[model samples]
Target: MTATTTAANPDAPATAPRYEISVGGMTCAACAARVERRLNKLDGVSASVNYATERAQVSCGPDVDPRLLVEQVQRAGYQARRVDDVAGADGDDDSEQARRVTDLRRRLAVAAVLAVPLCDLSLALSLFPELRFPGWQWVCLVLAAPVVGWCALPFHRVALAGARHGRSSMDTLVSGGVLASSAWSLWVMVAGGTPAPGLGQGLSVVNGGGHALYLEVAAGVTTFVLAGRYFEARAKRSAGAAMRALLTLGAKDVEVVRADGTRRVPVTELLVGDVFLARPGEKIATDAVVVEGRSALDVSTLTGEPVPREVGVGDQAVGGAVNVGGWLRLRATRVGADTQLARMARLVRDAQQGKAAAQRLADRVAAVFVPAVLALAALTAAGWLLAGQPAGLALTATVAVLVVACPCALGLATPTAVLVGTGRGASLGVFIKGPAALEATRAVDTVVLDKTGTLTEGRMRLVDVRPASGQASAELLAMAGAVEAASEHPIAAAITAEAGAVPAVTEFEALPGLGARGLVDGRAVVVGREPLLAELGMAVPDELRAGRGELERAGATVVLVGWDGHARGLLAVADTVRTTSAAAVAALRGLGLHPMLVTGDNAGTAAAVAAEVGIDDVVAETLPADKVDVVRRLQRDGHRVAVVGDGVNDAAALAAADLGMAIGAGTDAAIEAADIVLAREDLLVVPDAVELARRTHRTIRGNLWWAFGYNVAALPLAMTGLLSPLVAGAAMSLSSVFVVSHSLRLRAFRPNR
Candidate 1:
C-alpha cells in the first residue's frame, strides 16, 4: 500500500517525498488521529492517518527524515514503519495480517473455552444456592484466572502502552472494565471468611454492599470483547481483498526478444524499450506498443469490458491483457511500477487510505472519546452513591459504562465502507479517485456529455463521395486522399483508408480544425471544409453543392475537395454512435440527472446524436473554452454538473464541472483533470460510476448514523444502571462487528446489466 512520490531540486534546500507507512497498535479513531497529529507536527510535513487500513500517508521534505516520522509515531504510543522499505526488504510480506488473525483466533478460542463454563457454573450456583459444591468458588476462581490474565493480556498491554504516553484508547476501557470486575471478585474471595454451604447465597445481590463476587462478569466481558476483536480483524482483511487480488494480476515473467533469440526473464528484470513476445493465451508482459503481428486481446480483468479488442501493429497494449488470438511482438513503453496495472492498484490503495470529511469529524470526536467515557463513568458512579444507591449498584453502573462506550464502531464506519465501495467500483471498470469524488456524486443533478469519443465512436468514416461533372471518381478520391494522407485528423484517416493507395504528396500543410493542403502529383490538391475552400478562391459547382447540403442535413460532415482554384468533388464523413450510448443516457436520467450534449461539432450533427441518445439539451459548435462556459452556466443555474469526455480539448471543462469522469483510453491531461475514470469503452459505466458513488456515499452515511445512534441510545441505558457488564461487553463488541459486516455488504454490489 505504499505510494511514493519525490521531487528533487539541486538548488533548493531539500527534496519532498510523499509516501505511506503502516501503523500498528491503533485500536480506534483516536489512535489514528494521535498518529496523524504527531506526524504533522514536523516542519514542512503533512499527514493523513486511516484507522481502517492501519496506514498513514505522510508528505515531508528530505530534511524531515522518515526515521524521525517513525519515531514520532512511536512516541505517540504506536509502532510504525515505512511500507516501501518493508516491501523492498522483504519482497511482498503478506504474512503480517495472517499472523495477526491467527494470534487473535487463538486468544479468542482460549477465552471462549474457559469463559463459557466459568459463567455457566457461576450463574447456576448463584441462581440456586443448593447447587453450590464445597469448592465451587475455588473452581470459578481458577477458570476466571486464565481468561482475565492471559486471554485479556493484549488489552492490558495496549492500555499500559497508552498510559505510558499519557494517552488512551478503546483498549483502555476494555482493560479497565475487565480488571475492575476481577479485582472486586478477588477481594471478595480473599477478604470474606471461608464459607462452606452458603458461599453463593448473596452473590446475585443488586442493591447490596459491594461484596458480591463478579467472577462471571469478568470472564464473560473478556470473552465477548476478544471475540469482537477477532471477527473485526478478519472482516477488515476481507474488505481489502479485491485490491489485493488486483495488485497480483500482473505477469510474473516475460519472453524478451533479444539480439540472439527470445529469453524468458522475470517481469521485474524487464526494462523499458525492451521488445517482448506474447504468444497465444499469454498475458502481455507490460504496457507496450505492438511492433509486429495481429491478435485479439482480452482486457476484461483490467477494464471489465467482456469483448475482446482486436489489436494490430502500432496499437498499444496494457499490462495484464491476455493475447488470445495470435502471437505478437511488443516493445515495452512502461515496465514494473510504471505500468497501467501498477498505477491502478496504487490509485485504489490511496483512495482506501484516505479519510473522508465525515471520518475526520468522527476522529475528532473520538480523539477525546475514551477519556470522556472514563470521566462519565466516574460521574455516574459518584452520582449514584450521592443519590443513596447501594455500592453494588454503583459498581455495576460504572463497569457497564466503561464496557459499553468503546468508540470502535465510530472508527470502523467510514474507512471500511470506502474500502469495499472503491473495490467494488474497480471491479466494474469505474475508478473513484477518492472520498471527494464520492461526495461529488451526492448532489449532482446535471450530466454534460461530450459528443465525439463519448456518445459516438469518434472514429470518422467516409459515407458518401460525389464527383464533379468532368472528374472521374477515382481521380478525385486519389487527389483528396493523397493530400489528406499527410494529415492526421479523423476525417483525413477516413478518406485515406477508403482510398486504399494514393500518389505521394509534397509541400503538405495541415490547417488546424479546417483541413489540409498539399501538392499531390504536382497538381496542388486541397481537401478541407467548405469555408476553407471558399477562402482559397475555389467555387463549388452546382451539383456538388447540392450533394453537400443533402449529406450535411443527414448529419454527415462534408469537406470540399478542390484543386487549381476549382471544386472537384464532395466527400461526406460521419461518426457512428456507440451501441450502448442510448442505454447509458437513459440510465443517467433514471438516476435523476439531466443529460446534455456538449460538442464542438456543427448543430445538425450534435442534434442528430442527441436525438439518437434520448438527450433533449444540446450545446453545439462550442470550442474548448465554450464547453467550460456551458458547465459554469448550468452550475450557476442551480445544477451540479458532471462532465464526461475523453480528449485533451475536454480537460478544461472536465475540471470546471462539479464532477469529471474521463474514459480510460483518453489523453493523460483529461484523466488528470477528472475525478473518476471509466476504464471500459461502453458508455454505460458513466451511469455505473455515478450510481456507485451515490450508493457508496449512502452506505457511509448509514454506517455513521448507526454507529453514532448505537452509542447515543446504548450509553444512557448503561449509565442509568440498567445494563449489566456482560451484556455491555457483548453489545460493545457487536457494534464494531456490525459496522464491519455492514461495510462488507458492498463487496456484493453488482453493476447494472
Candidate 2:
C-alpha cells in the first residue's frame, strides 16, 4: 500500500491524502476497533484498522499532520509508525512476525514447566488427605507464583495498558481471572490455616469447606492459554508463505552490459534503460524487451504454465522468468517498483488488508464483548450468594465466567480464512482483488466470455495446407512462402511459419492491396487473393476454389498460393481456439454458471467458434463500446454476470459487469479494470478461481458460526457452576485454535479440472 502526504496549500481546496499506519500492541479485535475509533475522532479523518494485518489505512484532510495521527494511536496505548517510512523494505514485516513467534514459544515453555508441578501438588492434597503434609500449601504457592506473575506477564501488561486508556479487551478478562484465583489462594494460605482434604475432589482448585485454595487454577489457566497463542501465531505465519515464495523468485544479481565489458551488479542497482545479459537457467533481472539473441523462457513461476515460451528479439520478458534455452540480452523497460512482479506483490498485500462484511459485524460485537462478560460474571457471583451457596463456590463460578467467554475466536474468524485463501489462489495463478471480490463470486450465475483472446488464441496461425492435383506439396509451399515472406501481413507470416527453411527470394515486388510477387529458385511466384493471381495472368483450378470456400465457411481465413500461371495450393489460417477452452466451458456448466460468447466478430465466425468451445449462447457482431450494454441488459434480467477479456476494448465491459476476470496475457488496461486476474493463459483457471472463492467464503462462514456459537453455549455452563475455571480456560483457548486451524484447510484447496 502506497500513501502520499504533501504540504497543504491554503488557497486551494483541501484534498484528502491517504496514509498507512502500522499499529502495534493490539491483542484482540476490540483493540483494533479502539484504535480505529480514536483515529476517526480527528476532524476530517477516516480510518479503518485491520487486526490481522496490524495496519490502519487512514484518509485525512491535507491540512492534518500525519504525526498527529501517530500521537492519537499512542494515546490509545499502542505503538504507531508511518508504514511508508518504517517498512520501506520488504523483509521488515516478516522479521517482526518471526520475533513474535519466538517470544510466544519461550513464554509458553516457561508456563508449562511451572504449572505442571503446581497443579499436581494441589490436586493430590485435595483428593487424598494422607498427601496433605505440613506446609504443603507453601509448596503450591512457591510453584504457582512464577507461573502467574512472570509467565502470564504479557496478558497482564496488555491488560494494564488497556486499563490506563479506560479500555477493555480479551487480555483484560484473562488477567482478571489469573489475579483473582492467585489472590484468593494467597489469602487462604495466610488466614484460613492448613486446609483439610475432601473426598471426590476435582483437580485444579482445592476446597475443604470454609477454606478453598486456587493456586492450580491460576497456574493451569496461564499455561493452557499460552500454548494456544503459540500455535495460533505459527498458523498465521504459514498463511503468508505464498507471498514470501513470490518475493524469493527474483534474481539477486544481474549482469549489466557496460562499455568496459559486462559488469556484475546487484539487482537493486540495475536501472531502467540498462542492458543486461541472462545466460541459460538465469532469471530475468526485471521487465525488459529482448534486444539480442533468442531463448525459450520458463514462466511457470509467474504464470503457472508448464510450457516454455519461445522468444526472439523484440519480445517482452517479465522479471522472475527463467531463460531455459540459449542466451538473451535484454534492455530493461521497467525496474524496481514499476515492474510487474512488484505490482503483483502490492496487490496481494492490499487484498489482505480488506475485511469482509461479516468480519465487521464480529468486530463490533467483540468491542463490547469483554465488558459484557465482566458484568455477567458479577451477576453470577451475586445470584449464587443469594441462593444460599457458599462464598467459595460463588467465587469459583465467577472466575469460570470470566475465563470461559472468549473474544479471541471472534477476532480471528474472517481474516485468517481470507489470508490463506488469497495466498493459495496466488499460487494457483489466481489473484483476487480482496474479500469483496471473493464475495462477488458467490452470486455470479452467468459468465460473459469475450471470444477474441479469451476462448481463442487471438493470433492467426496455420490450420491447413492444400496442394493442387499433379503438384508436389513441398515445392508449391516453398515458392508461396518465399513470395509471402516479403509481405508483413498476418496471413503471410502464417504461411512462412508453415514452410520452414524455404529458399530465399530475389527481386521481390510489393502489392499494397494484395500479396507480394518475387523470383524464388529462378521461378516467378505470386501469392495473394484470387485478384492477385488473376492480375498475374494465373487461373485458379476449380478444385482449389471449392477447397477455399470450405475453409472460409468453418471460420478459417483462406488465401491462394499459386505460381507458373496457375493456382497450386490453398492455405487456411484463423485465430484457433485454445485446447483448454472446451473443458473450461464444461467446468463452468458444472458449477451451474451459464456461459455465453460476446465479441466483435461477425455472426457466422462467432457462432462457429462458440460451437467449437461448447458454448450454446452467442451474442455476435457487437461493437467494443456496446459490450457494457450487453452486461447491463443481463443484469436487468436478474443475472449476476462475470466478464472475462484480455484487450483494451474489453476494459469498459469488464468494469461494468458484476465481476471482472482478466486473462494474464492481456493488456494493462484490462488487467487494471478486473476484479480477479488469471495469471495463466489456460481458460481452466477461470473455473478454479470461482470454486476457490466459493469454498473460502464457506470456510469463513463456518468459522464465524463456530466462534459465536461456542461463546454463547459455554458462557451459560460457566455461569451455572457446571464448569471450573481451569476447564474454562482450556475451552476458551481451544476455540481460538479451532478457528485458525479451520482456516488453514484452504491451503489444501485444489483446482477443479
Candidate 3:
C-alpha cells in the first residue's frame, strides 16, 4: 500500500523536515527577530520565533543539515544546539535572567531621561503662551528620536516581525502611530515653511493662518509610550524572578579533585563519575553517594522540611543540600544540568509558559485587532476627504484617526492585570499557572477535592482502643506499640505515639502482606490484620468484630494485636478531616460553585468526609484514570469543573479538568499537571485565588472598555477639523494615563471572603 501511494504522488512536494534547535543569546524582541530573519535567509528553511519564550520552530527541506544551521547561528553570535524536541528544553540560569533584567533597566533609564525634556517642552508649549523657544522645542524633538529609535525599538521590530509573519499585534498599532506623527512633524520643522501639502490648510486654520510645528506632540507621545513599555517590561521581569530565585539556589562553582590536584570550575562543567570532597558546614555540589564520611545533612531547600537528616557512608546526598556535621567524600551520581535544582527550574519555566485557554482567546482577539483598527482609520479619513474637505483637513483627520485609535490602552489591559494579580498571588503563597487558570477558577461550577493529604491531615492517628476479654487497655497498647516500634507504616507511627517509654525490642521482622512480629521484653509480640491472625490460627471474638465494623463505618482502619497465640485487643486509626474544610466548601458555595469530593477510598469513607466538609456530592473508590472520566462527565452535565488533589495519582485528573489545582505539599508530577498549586496547603486558598482572579478580570475588562470607548468617541471629533493636532495629542495622552490609573486599581483589590 505504501509503495502504491508513493508511486501515485510522485509530483507532490516532500514533507518538510522539522528541526529542534536550542537557541541562545536572545535578549529582547529585536534579537528574536534577528535570529528569525537570519534563519529564514538560510536555503530550504522556514522559521517562526517567539521572543517572550525564547524558542523557535523551524521547518526545512531534506537537503538542509540541522548541524549546519546550528553552526551558522553560533557564527552569528548566538549559541544553537540541535535536539530532538524543543518542548523538553530546560530553562536558562540566573545569570541569563539577570542579564535580561539589566537590559530592560537600561532601556527604561533611557526612556525616562528622554521623557523629561519631551514632557517639559510639550507642557510649556501648551500651557504658557510666551515661554515658547523654537530652538528648545527642536532640541526636545531631537532627543526624543533616539529614545524612540533605540529604547522603543522593540515595539517597532516586533510589529515588523508580525507583519512579516502575516499577522498584526500591539506593536503594529504603536509603531504606526508614533512613526507617522513624528515623520510628519519633522518634515514641517526642517522646511521652515508651510506645512506639508496635506497638513498646511488644517494648521492654517488651527494656528490662525501661520505654519505651526507640532514637534512637541510627536516627542511627548513617543516618550510616554516608551515609559509605559518600560514599566510593563519591569512587571514581566518581576514575575520571572521567582524562577531565577530557584535557579540561584544551586552552587555556581565547585571544588574538583583530579589525579594531579584540586581546582575550582563552574558547576556546569562537572560530570558524572567525578568525585568531590565536602567539608563540614559546606553544601554538596552534586547528587552523590557518600564514599568515605558521615554527616547530618540539611535537605530542607529541596524538601521544605527543616530538620537535619543523618547520612553515613553508602547513603546518598542530593545536590544543593547542606552538609552540617562532618566532612564527606562523595562520588557524583548526577551533576551539572542533571541536578534536582536544574530540574525544578525547568519545571517552573514550563509551568509559566503553558498558556491557559483564556489567554489564547485574548491572543486571538489581539491578533486581528490592529488591522481592523487600521482599516477603520483609513475609512474615516477617506470619508472626510470625499466630503470636499481640503488636503490639510484630510491629513489632520488621518493623523487623529491613527493617534486616537491606537490600541495602546486596550493592549495593556489584560496583561497588566495578570502581571499584578500573579505577583500578589505569589506573595500569598498561591502559584497560578497562567491567565487561563486564573480565569477558569472564576467560572468553575464544580470543585473535585482529593481526600488524602488535602481535606484531612495526612498523618494517621489512633482514635480508639478496645480491650480483649482478659487484658487491660494500657497493657494491650504497650505490647502493640512494642511490636510496631520497628515498623515504618502509618499504623506504626500511631502505635509508637501510644507506646510512650516502652522497652526497646532486640529483633524485628516485617511480614509484607500481614503485619510485624518482634521480640518485646523477650516475648513474641505480633501486630497485623485479621487475615494474618486467622493464618496463625487465633480465635476472633464477636465484640472485637463488631468494633471493627464501627471503625470501618467511620472511615478508620482496624488492626488486631496478639501475644503468643491469644487475641489482645483492637486498635483503630484514621486520618481526620481538617476543621477548616467545612468553611472552605461553604465559601466556594457562596461564590456559586458546587463543591464535590472525589476520592480513592470506599463509599463509606468518602461519604463520611463529604458530610464533614458540608459537601453533598461524592464519588468514591475512583481510580486515577477514572477521575478524568468523572471530570468529563461533570463538564458534560453543564458544569465547568475544577479538580483539586495532592498526590501523584491525582495528576491525570488535574490535567483533565477545566481548572486543575494541586493542594498541599504534593509530588512534582502533580504540581506540574496543575494549573494552580496552593503552596500553603489550605483549601481556603482555592476560593481566595478564584475571587482574586475574578476581580482582576473585571478590572481588565472595565479598563479595556473605557480605553476603546474613549478613542472611538474622540477620534471622530478630531478628524472633522473641529480639533487640532495639539488637542488630539493631549486627549490621546490623557486617555492612556486614564487606562493606566484604572489598571492600578488592581493593587488595592482584596479577595472576598
lDDT of each residue in 5-54, candidate 3, tens digit only: 01111243446665546676543333444566678788777764444444
RMSD of 1: 4.7
Error of 3 at 371 (Å): 4.2
lDDT of each: 0.83, 0.83, 0.65
* TM-score for each predicted model, relative to the true structure: 0.88, 0.84, 0.62
Most TM-score-accurate candidate: 1
TM-score of 3: 0.62
Measured on C-alpha atoms, candidate 1 has an lDDT of 0.83
Candidate 2, residues 505-571: lDDT per residue as tens digits? 9999866335678999888888766777987889989999888777868897667877778888877
At residue 375, give the lDDT of candidate 2: 100
What is candidate 1's lDDT per residue for 357-451, written digit by digit as tens?
89888988888888899999899889889999866667778888999986889989999999999888888888888888899999999999998
lDDT of 3 at 341: 53
Off by over 4 Å in 1: 1-16, 85-94, 193-209, 462-550, 558-572
C-alpha RMSD values across all candidates: 4.7, 8.1, 9.8
